[model samples]
Target chain A: MKKAVPLYIGTAALCMVGFAYTLYQIFYVAPLAQAPLYYNQKIFYYHVPCAFMLFAAVITCGIASIKYLRKREERWDDVAFAAAEVAVMFGLIVLVTGVLWAKPAWDKWWVWDARLTSALLLWMTMLAYMLVRKYGGAGAERLAAGLGIFAMINIPLVYASTRLWKTNHPSANTVPSLDSSMRAALWLSVLLFTFFFILLLRLRIDAQRAERRLYRCREMALDAGLFE
Target chain B: MDFLQHVKTLAWKDIRVEFRSREIVYTMTFFAGMVVLLFSFAFLRESSAANGGMITDASLSPGFIWVAVLFSGTLGLSRTFDRERETGTMRGLLLSPMPRAAIFLGKAVGIFVMVLVVQAVVLPLVALFFDAPLFDHPLALLCLTLAGTLGFALVGSVFAAMLLKSGSREVLLPVVLYPILVPLFIAAIKGTATMMSGSMSETWFWIRFLLAYDLIFTVAALWTFEHLVIE
Candidate 1:
């Protein structure tokens, strides 16, 4: 087993259990009376958790960005890249699931409400960050780190725009606004998604390191004239 | 005294270079004109009550004008640094003695000035075509424009710097900037629109938002600029 096996196992186990419970809440255990409110669309349990995880991943990206800038460590860049990639994945999930929820709940596939628009903006920024990394070359680490910090700056903007503008977007909970049963279920979902994010990030980081190692090996072999 | 001299020299160099080419300003103004014209035709038809409402309402709703401005502003952004990269001059400037912050700020202020000039021309054209009265509070509107443009230029400059060396400079600049700029545009345009519509009572809040936007991004750009351009 690799050095990351324990973390992988722990996260996979936690996520599996949480995902199972989330499925139960969305499909089986959720009350039919509450269906009108969500209209058998309690899949928002999964959606909202993913949204939170997306935010958490972006924040971590920002932290890693700062670390890279301050320390100039390639590791921090690696971690930042991992977090940003995960944020993009989770952000895409939020967008898709939110659109899914919106179609049934709002009778429209998408609304230009502040929350949705801001979320879309965030998704665009994440995609841009990934692109910057893909093409940035020798300067990729620093360039992507700079963009990661810049992208994180959008989160607060997204939050504030929802408040300042007259959009139909739901205001983020000032405090977790769920009752006991709902809160327990919601927290579990969030925990599970966080674990999933961790697993994905670790896997991404490992792949990146492996890629880096292969490049270094190729460079060494070429220098040794192994091919010739 | 010497630091101020460096700032002035760099600003002048950028402006002078831009003048010699004038392509940046021309492209930006032309694009801004097209956008406003398109929106006018789309939303404000030749004759209708809806047109009348849109004309009167456009300035009142800063969202419309600011968005037009923001989208068009990207034209200036990609060109600002993209020109330098095209000519292979960005690295030469980076090798100069000017502080990176000064380079960042000077380029920003130059672009802000350029964008404001475009807005100055475009806003009146928008008003004339739509029959909207935009000069109701010219001074206050100017203040909002300056503050808003400064913030946009600040953030835009950093992204432009980062994208200058990237493959798809045009595509990447707006992708990184549009979302981060949402709040700045929202607050500034709201302030401008409100002032134009005789709603200056909310001036303080908008001013604060503008100032906050400028401060945060200026500090952020200054802090990270060295990391960005220093290789």
Candidate 2:
């Protein structure tokens, strides 16, 4: 715990630095957008990074959930819970930013395109995971673990199924075709978001750890007749 | 050999229990019928008003039919598991000398059949009410519904069992199942819509997707039930 403090602060400091630099590059270095989307297109840099991080968060939650289900360990559940909450934050940003970008780019506030719908459904499942964890009562942990795994498995299927709607959102490889300056800015933004993601995950895991420890203390105190 | 027989017997037990009262089937079909009726009430007039008679858009029937299938599917799934939890029979069934996967498979098979039975009423009703041609490719339609129903049942049975002991099972069941089953619903609806449009190749594509969904989730549900369930 003591050693982790410095690493946490260092990551936070590095992330701040990265964000400051990336924002400068995005605003100043990255060239003006093309005809249709001149100014608002900058949202793509933020939106794409958040979208990528959301995927990372979900996959992390799923892996941690598998471990928790297999071992029934408190630590694994903590990791899974932390990852899920982080996923929700990132997922929200992805959807909102994507929608904001869409209004200017696609001339629609929302599109029923494959990528958008899949992201929407995936975010909803993550929201359900949070709901079940909060309200599922006694066996909430097990139920949540099942949901986390199921959510991960549905990722590919959801994307594939919604593709039938004839997608208009930028394709997956659109990132590669961007101008060199904009692409560099986007990469820097992604790096900054990665740092931020790690900081949030670590903080949440620590909070969950503290919570379970307090719970154990209360149970032990009750057993010892200290409270009664 | 032994496993299949065990699964069959367990499924048979469920069917017999269901046949005795027929409460689940009757109410489920009725609920589905109401959904179909409501669809007609809501959209039939809109379409009729648009063109002044039954020039009902065929592309739209698939969405209505699937809504009914999914809604009634959730209604019956929780009730089916509630029956087990009410009498503590799930525990007994778990305790008996049979594989855990068998119980899961048997229960899924039972619900799969029930949802299919409900869909039987739903399809013709949607067609009759909406005046949409959903039966042009009979074989494709059959395969699509079967595959879609199979995916729905496999996922629904596991979730219904997971939420069995929870207090908010009624609300939580659909809250949990609908999002997870979105892919299945999309594929099924797409398949039906394509069939209505007389597109065999695309309809088969969606059917294949649904079949793959069933295969993956069937394994996932069995694994999850075995590990997640406790007496």
Interface RMSD of each: 2.1, 0.7
Tens digit of per-residue lDDT, candidate 2, span B1-231: 989988999889888999898999999999999987777667643443645764445557899889998999899998899999999999999999999899988998999889989999999987877778877777898999899998998999889888988888899889889999999998988888888888788988999999999999988887788878756
* Model 2 segments more than 4 A misplaced: B46-56
lDDT of 2 by residue, A169-211 (tens): 8787888899999999999999889989989999999999989
Q: For candidate 1, what is the total of clashing residue pairs?
A: 1
Instruction: Considering the two chains of model 1, state its CAPRI-style docking category.
Output: medium
* Per-model DockQ against the true two-chain complex: 0.51, 0.85
User: Model 1 scores what on Cα lDDT?
Assistant: 0.77
Number of the top candidate by DockQ? 2
Number of the top-ranking candidate, with lDDT as the measure: 2
- What lDDT does each candidate get? 0.77, 0.89
Q: Please tell me which predicted candidate would have the highest TM-score against the true structure.
A: 2
* Tens digits of per-residue lDDT for model 1, A34-83: 44445535666778888888888888999999999999887788899999
For model 1 chain A, the run of ten residues with the poorest summed lDDT: A31-40
Measured with C-alpha atoms, the lDDT of residue A137 in candidate 2 is 85
Q: How does residue A67 of candidate 1 score in lDDT?
A: 95
